[model samples]
Target: MTEISKISLRNLQKRFGEKVVLNGVDLDIAPGDSMVVIGSSGTGKSVMLKCILGLLRPDGGTIQLDGNDIGTLRQRERNALLRHVGMLFQGGALFDSLPVWENVSFGLLGAGGISRRDAKDHAIETLAKVELDAPTADLYPAELSGGMQKRVGLARAIAASPDIIFFDEPTTGLDPITADVINNLILERVQELGATTLTITHDMASVGKIASRVAMLHDGKIIWSGNASDIDRSDNPYLNQFIHGEAIGPMRPDVSTTMPKETY
Candidate 1:
């Protein structure tokens, strides 16, 4: 049987002032599929994720989750839908004020009203799932290294056992070994839960390791998408340039004009 799509975007469009971020972008992710969206900076990759999360309202098009149009949902309804989704932000975005376990169980404490003792137990279990030891649970975010913090963030994201997970720049700013470990952890967790995931990253290594399907975003649209094995043989000039990290291609010259000077 064909798997149903957990998330679908049809002709999705978003704009910040006069700048069009996503223009007629369409994609479908089957339940339990791992899709990695690769793109250069300023291609609206983050915006696309935000639109799906209802953090940013799109100017046009539709975003559907389980066949329901969530783009037009009221705040309460949107929050209800978001309850089933988990997110690992780009920066590990942990609250410095909270201890590690508190950070990891924040969602459970707030949304599920899980008792503190039960929440701590769940947090410890989730942390172990990410290969983190129990000792790190009491340490503050400031005391942990970057990789440890990321693991904590991952633990927190999965604490709710969300049906869908969104990973933004999961491997960014990590040493090679650490990045690989995180990638493997992501794969293990997704497989363990059979949850659909959408990841946004430019790291080709992470792409090869974690993605079942790859999509290339450019000029506010998904210009190309295919299975992971086909990526090396895609023959699409844009895909070639991106995966190879080349300075010259159909995608290069256009980059200079895409982002504002201050962003550089």
Candidate 2:
């Protein structure tokens, strides 16, 4: 009901039988805003994203895109609405057998009518935007280093020029310098497109480089949110524990409640 936000979630709730993943979650992302959601694993970060993506259905609450409730749309209508979105998975999620160019242009190719030659050309151009040279497009995912694979994934996500993008752990496994490079690329591409982006990352460094605003999810709810610059100065104990990588704080280590321990 609020067009003010590009994406809005209100009292979002989800459960997997006995376990509740998202409990009364609420958040809003404004147009062209880069909002990063940070939390330890199993804190419902992915679940919340999935709900918004409509990959998983929430048991309660509403997900709105430009003020229209997604749940109210028909299946075909929903699919049409989703066409404007792009995603970069945590693991790159490239098809190992496909050439890098095919992977980058997967969505573009899927829409039909584009010749393979043109698709490859478009893919190479997109790759260049991510600082990857044209020759890299001929290789498969396995042939590239971890950093290169990430760049290809980023190229794919932006190839379609979607107005909204989702990044799941954009900088997961790489040297700090490599991670920083990827972070900078992400910032550049998003700014270039002027797209609204939702990124899920525990890496404070990536958050610092990419997020305009930061929200922390804990215990299936948003516990803190503010301008990215305010993270370090916030007096919230949970945030302090997280950003500082402290072992003790308001957050406890429950095997059932967290993702892998994050040092960033």
- Candidate 1 residue spans exceeding 4 A from truth: 1-3, 253-264
Candidate 2 lDDT tens digits, 1-264: 266899999999987766777889889999988999999877888888878888877899999986779989898888777768888889999999999999999988888889999999999999999999999999999999999999999999999998999999999998999999999999999999999999999999999899999999988899999999999999999999999988988887666543432122
lDDT of model 2 at residue 135?
A: 96
lDDT, model 2: 0.90
State the C-alpha lDDT per candidate.
Answer: 0.89, 0.90
- Candidate 1 lDDT tens digits, 1-264: 113778889899988766888988998998878999999988989999988987777889998887779966788887877778889999999999999999999977888767999988888989999988898899999999999989999998888889899999998999999999999999999898888999999999999999998999998899999998999988899999999999978875453455432121
User: Clashes in model 1: which pairs?
Assistant: none
Estimated TM-score per prediction? 0.94, 0.94
TM-score of 2: 0.94
**Stretches of candidate 2 exceeding 4 Å from the true structure:** 256-264
Residue 219 miss distance in model 1 (angstroms): 0.4
Model 1 residue 130 lDDT score: 95
